[model samples]
Target chain A: MAEEITTTEEKTVDKDIAALLTSPPKRAPEPTPELTGKIVKPKIVQGAAAHYKPHVAKPEIQEKLGFPGTLVENWQEAAVAKMRELLGKYKSLQVYMDICVRCGSCTDKCQYFLSTRDPKNMPAGRAELFRQVYRKYFTTEGKIFGKLAGAVDFDLSLLAEWYSYFHQCSQCRRCSLYCPYGIDTAEISMAAREIMDSIGLGQKYTNEIIGKVHELGNNLGMNEAALRNAIEFVEEEIEEDTGVPVKLPINEEDAEVLLVTPSADFFATPHLESLVGYAKVFHQAGINWTLSTTAAEAGNFGMFVGSYYHMQKIASRIKQAIEELRPKRLVVGECGHAWRVAYAFWNTLIGPFDMLNQKYPRPQHICEFTLDLINRGALKIDKSANDEFVVTFHDSCNVARATRMGDKPGGQFDIPRELIKAVTNKYVDMEYDTIRERTFCCGGGGGLLTDELIDVRVKGAMPRMQALHNVMETHGVNFMALICAICKAQFTKIMPKYGIPMEVAGGVHQLVGRAIVLGAKE
Target chain B: MSGLTLLYTLFAYVAIAVFLVGFLARIWKYATTPSPLKIPLTPAPVNSVGVVYRMVQEVGFFKSLFYSNRIIWIGGYLMHIALLITIVKHLRFFFKTTPAALAWITSFEIYVGFIFFGALAFLFLMRLVIDRTYYLSLMQDYVLLIFLMLIAATGILTKYYVRTDIIKVKQFVMGLVQFRPEAIPGDPIFIIHFTLVLLLLIYFPFSKLMHSGGIFFSPTRNQVDDAREVRHVTPWAVKG
Candidate 1:
């Protein structure tokens, strides 16, 4: 009887251990009203991570950027050495790797993990992919115990995992907001991408765009003539609509302001509308603003790849433009990460703008310029002009989290909403958490907006889409206003995938354009 | 000294040395590493004073975690607070004359131990039961929690069920602090409890527990949001 009891107890303990060791398979999250927009509890789905991997950059593109043409012979050693180099270079990377207590505060905060139940998509899990390697090679415990300390050796599978999942992160920094240690996953992802690039494993979308910026002075490779023509087309269209000859000045020296905007504004719809809005604001404000052929594009792809040299190189075009044009003020148009790079990094990267007028901020956002005009009663707005559509704003991740808009701390959140409310009578915010500093990425920011990453983009957009869906159902909100060029483009492309109309996506300045009484001020 | 007492004394010295040296080295590395860019997750405080205030709120109240998930905040915050109290209570062992305030803290030791153990169990169970937490959890994560739980349980057992020579345990601890070796008390439960603590000290620097130090060094948490005003540059990135 004693022997039998002991045998049964042993069997039960083994069964419990077995159950604990084996994880359940990934399941598709059930679609519910709460999942759509109500901010429901976070649920775990198995195998939900890294469903798609983006294509790698071609050797030519890689070589142009001064990276290896192909994966090195000893890639593992190279990657590890790159990590060590980065540890010395970036305090954020080093501290983030050391700190993350995996308290699960940020687990539910990441949109990628929320959309795809893949464990690796979780911010902690994502950082762990790099931390594991850091531990094994750099730390003492990992050297002795290895797997027992959650450390793993560098291998091809791990490298492949890095490529697939790091790209999945839009580097939105939402997870960092909730992390107790403020471990920004963007810092880790940037370091990982930098390391991968060091070993010649670069993403095609970001590298290709950076190459174009290096060669053509813009992300779209538009030459000076092409850019001139695009601006002329906008000038004509605005004149026909408002009967005002709002000159879209180009390459003109002695202008009061230099307008540097994303190339998408020149070519893409909704984005172009904002470009028109900027011109109207400039024309009405009587600010002598000119577009530069050299620094035509505000969006810098160098930030996406995590290369400071390339980021500096790309940002130098704007500095060159500032030097040659000698504009009294620098006003950036609707671009997300570009604004972050300009607002947060430009001063450090290429600044001490002693030459320009100190009357204005060294680099002012276009929204800030327009909003100031409105606030000062310098510009008249017909709020009822946008009565046909109900609007809600989507805060671009970089603008919401990475940079400030005005002197106050949360001016990024208020300035855009204040602009929207100024332009339209009907405006409703998405859930409190889904907007402001706690906003979700447009699934396409951070260089993952390329055509090849469409599937990842679509899946990654689930949280934002759900938030929009809820508002659309409750308030009948027909227009989604955005400040970021990437957000506008991404929403335009992916909103249709979720059964929402593509026309719903547009720039905040698009509303500004419709409501601004152009000739009234004159 | 007997073999058992000598073995434990040697282990105590090694553990303390590893803990302090390893922790200080990690802190130094984090401190000296350069952050080339101004990448504070914004809506951040604009001044250094504000940044210090933000860090204090984050470390003291787990403010970010509170904003993130309440359940996690409760478990994590409670565990940390309980651990802090327990550490204060344990200070009586080292001091020849326990401070009046510390004597008061020792009075609540049993309650602190219960809360600590309870919070640890909840956190450990969360890793097992919650699919997301479970998937993210590693063997070391589980082991750390279980190891801590065992330490708490053994301590409670020594205090309540199996009576241990507390005076001798304090003497041994005081002797260790004073650089004089003393025989460790031959109480089985106390021995187990004390050994687990030494192991924890040895493990703390090498594991995720370095978060205590790393939190202070985290650039995102520690950096002022005045990048625009300050023109912040690092040592390596400074041009001429």
Candidate 2:
């Protein structure tokens, strides 16, 4: 009987691989009027969900991060042991596993489930994938009844399911908003990824980037010289555009603030524009700020892999920079999850900035800074500068749901909008549901932003695309402003595939950069 | 006492013992476990008083469910509320004299029975009709719901359709509570209902029904969004 079961599992695995190879690349279907609404129902599409899985991390990358170099012979035991350890460590995991009543409130909340129509992509369904294993190994009913209790043995097929389905989740925490108990699937997904990594299975995108952050101090692996060159290029461009020679200072001591942002701002288009906007903001406000080569990157991929130690290690680089530079305050630039880490996790991870000035927020968001200046009338504005395009803000999931911006609770949502409205006249919001704390992910967050997962990424963007399409038809909205580097890059690549121009996606500060007067304040 | 009466008395003690011990153990585990990060789903309350108010709304009103899907909220809220009222009405069994405060609850026991059964039936039917719910519903999920439905049905039957001697039933329950054994009346429907209730008590701690207790321990609902102001340190996590 066991042999027969193994053979069937092998056959199922082969079938999934075949489907993946032969399947056409999934694209966002054109939104019809009926399909574009505030509360859209999930459409069923067969075989659309099982065809994408990210490539696994190489053995060296796995070993460098303190995981096994290859799949252990006793991987099942190791995985189960890790689960037990996590269950003991995290109250979120323990309570979430026991409490879900399967009420189906979160069924339609996940964008992946809505777009892919894969039942496993449902938040509860995805959680059950982990819960089933927990039941099999931990619960008494599972011990006696097994399959009758919805428990499955830890087998190769289950491992494959974990790989395919857990990667489908963006860990955006949108589902938690609707969950009656606030059962954040992001917590479950993080636990699942941690367990997988323990058994020597890891995703190439997240683990490799984490490895880069360990070795090169950033995700992009750019050294100090390249970082300086990039800053020089931005300064040269600022001078060319406004003829103001705005200084993009790097590694300067005694600066009041250290501006830590995603390295993508140095490499990617539109992301670069936001970097320029930060420089222009600092220039206009006349606040002394310098970029740190030690902590050049702000985005923390450790959270994606569910490694708290690694997340702290990566965040500590900024702590090291802070101690070295003695900056009075820390300001984080436009990146979604980075802000979540900086604002929410950094105090716990690496904090007690007792040496710095305490009057300003320990770590302030750029929008909060820019909006503060705009409110004080310290920066001159040109509202007509962005009149060529009607704009709307795409609230990144982490910023929208995970962290706060100003002193208030929903300040993350308001500060960015206030900044955009202060700079541009044609600002509008997308849809009420899709904009604020209930926002959909850019489909490429939580380390699925690699090229190989493009199929899953494009399919996941369907709901957000539909919302954007609705506003486009109704409001003639030409530009979608974003606060996340991943959202900016993802939408820039994804909008073209949906028949929207790439230029339609840009940074909120891109609008600010266009409209901010570059001269000394009045 | 008859042989059947002695068997039931023994079963009742064992089931209650297991239920109390297991339920407390699970709650203790949840209470003692450390949540390392601040992950309150925002728009969360900022202060402890606000957290208490938020939790009250969640427990009392199922506020998140009301905002998520109205139909599920109606089914869940109705069933949970009805069950609470019915349980309070059942307090008459344990007390030699029913308390004055519970007099109102006992008066509406029959209507509460109807709502309880009706809501349980709705939830069970939903498990079959809704596609997502159907996919997630395991055999145990269905079995537990159907078992509760039958318990509710048998209870209503004993109360109205075939009246059992409530005086004897109360004496038996009061005797058991006071540690003085008495012969339980052997009505067939009553026996079945009593046995099912015992089974539910045994199953409650081990099954997903522990959501009753687990909800309070959910970190996302319980944690305050004060990570910036206060440093939340756990013993297990490394100190910086």
Candidate 3:
């Protein structure tokens, strides 16, 4: 009987390990509204520790390269060599090291600093982690006393800090603008992430998401079956609301446009309603378009986690999907960073895809697509449905600055604003900033979507939330609309936290679905 | 009259005249360009305390003096501080009758000037050896550095090396200042050094070196970080 008890105890221990390996540890419940209506600011350590800890298993990635021990050693050597090589070869990289005067202007400027308050979160300190390395290895002063020159010795401890802080930065180039000498820390952060991944030390969540994107063509790990189910789900909802069975056609041979969005819409609420809106527009315009299950997602998570190979692989899938579908034009759905990744890098990575036999037209945002229809007299929008709320467009950072399309006039922001203006007379500018290249990032950037970093993301978003909040509180502004999927999730999730009651939705496409007066004869 | 005095006066006069013309020309060009915003690289006074904080923060906040990696900042700061001190101490040549206070300050400045001159030379070597500064550096950067070294070297030589008659050098300079034409200096070193300084001043307005004065107009550093708080409609926008 004692022997039997020992075996049972051993079995129980095995089960616990398996559970721990398979799932993230249970988080203490976040404070709810009843407990504290005020925003719960994560204590600096509490916030960073939560978002930065590895969640998914990384052993498989290590095992793929063979046994863990050998892989780790080889990765470290290779990563160090590559960093040294990059440093020695690239004059630009060296300039970054030599140029900093350490003026603390960039400290308070970082949103991460505002949110976390960690002195290390300052851009100067983050750059120093690498700067010290450069001085130690290359500079005359650093060759003597490494720490005195601001560099710590290369070790596992330093690597861990690198992984933690490098990911903390959102790669926003805002710091670049304020720098007296135009030092771009974003580039340094990217180089560091590359080194980390080369050494098999990348964050599990980002790498796993990237792997999913490659295998399944979406970051959420949704397959073709899942994509079909989501379409059917949206279709059912649309039928109940519009009283018409709107078919979200998939894989049609010759459609005019292919609608693509971030997979978050497939799993979340009111976002799928954007799909319904697009269907209504195409249905009313009598336009032909197909959604391809093979490449339904518009996201490119490679940039988020710092993996170029994954970025190229995901971009290739998008190109292939576009080729097979053979659409006249490609329309990107309401997603900010996705559009940026596609707009800025896709053409360079996957194209002159002319080999695929579909003369791929340039990608268009949904706002631009609707504006084209309205300008050409293809779709009619009645103002009645959108008349209730005075609307203003929130320029998402990725859309506004990261992507080339939105930076130009009459590009992304203009089309949406024009459509809104044509449809409504009640439109009011937010008491703060409005449209064009000058825009704020929605808080949920850099893939901080995990349930763990919710508080931090909400707090980082405070600056933007406050701007919109002020407009609503004082100027009677009510509706906030945006084009990026991340912005939609960011505003929708965090706005309630700040007691700002303004309703949030994606740009005119959702409003178009509700407002377009389709003919009874059709 | 010293030969060095004659050459120094001629070269110095020419450098000053060209420097003024070039400086004015550059200012004209800047005024013509369309930069309207005066955004500071440092955070602004959103509140009263922020203004004082901005001042303190500008003083090397760890990164200020030592932490920054930007080669330009390190080199630029060393070069500027050194040059400023050397110019202030070299004032004995420009003034006819030095004030008692000025004479005492000049004595102190001469000692400090040697360290700054050494610093200026080090900066020149840094620009040549460091690949980033070298590659991005324009012809003007070299010209500026070379001119500075020459000026510092000549000033040092007059004080300590090949000592010259200060009264004689002063008379030539005072004649030039008093709007009288004077014979060129005899010393080849003095002529070369003064001529290089003259050329640098003449070239300054057209070169990227104007970044000293042009930092105020730099769109990258000067544009306010208030984009999220305020709208900046670009001049190129096509209206709806």
Highest-scoring model, DockQ? 2
Chain A (candidate 1) TM-score to true chain A = 0.92
Candidate with better lDDT, 1 vs 3: 1
Cα lDDT of model 1 overall? 0.86
User: What stretches of model 1 exceed 4 Å from their correct place?
Assistant: A1-35, A38-51, A520-522, B108-110
lDDT per residue for candidate 1 within A4-89, as digits (tens), equals 99999878755643332232334453332233464444577655654466667778999999999777868889999989988889
Chain A TM-score, candidate 3? 0.82
- In model 1 chain A, the worst 10-residue window by lDDT is A17-26
Over B33-56, each residue of candidate 3 has an lDDT whose tens digit, in order, gives 442222222222333355445434
What residue pairs are clashing in model 2? Answer: none
Fraction of true A-B contacts recovered by candidate 2: 0.78
Angstrom error of the Cα, residue B69, model 3: value is 20
Q: How well does model 3 score by local distance difference test?
A: 0.60
**1 or 2, greater by DockQ:** 2
Per-residue lDDT of candidate 2, residues A241-304 (tens digit): 8899899888889998899999999979989999988888888889899999888999999998
Q: Candidate 3 docking category?
A: incorrect
DockQ, computed on Cα atoms, for candidate 1: 0.63
**Fnat for each predicted structure, in order:** 0.83, 0.78, 0.02
lDDT of 3 by residue, A338-418 (tens): 876665556555544343324333566777777777788887778787777677777776666454333232255566677
DockQ values, each candidate: 0.63, 0.77, 0.05
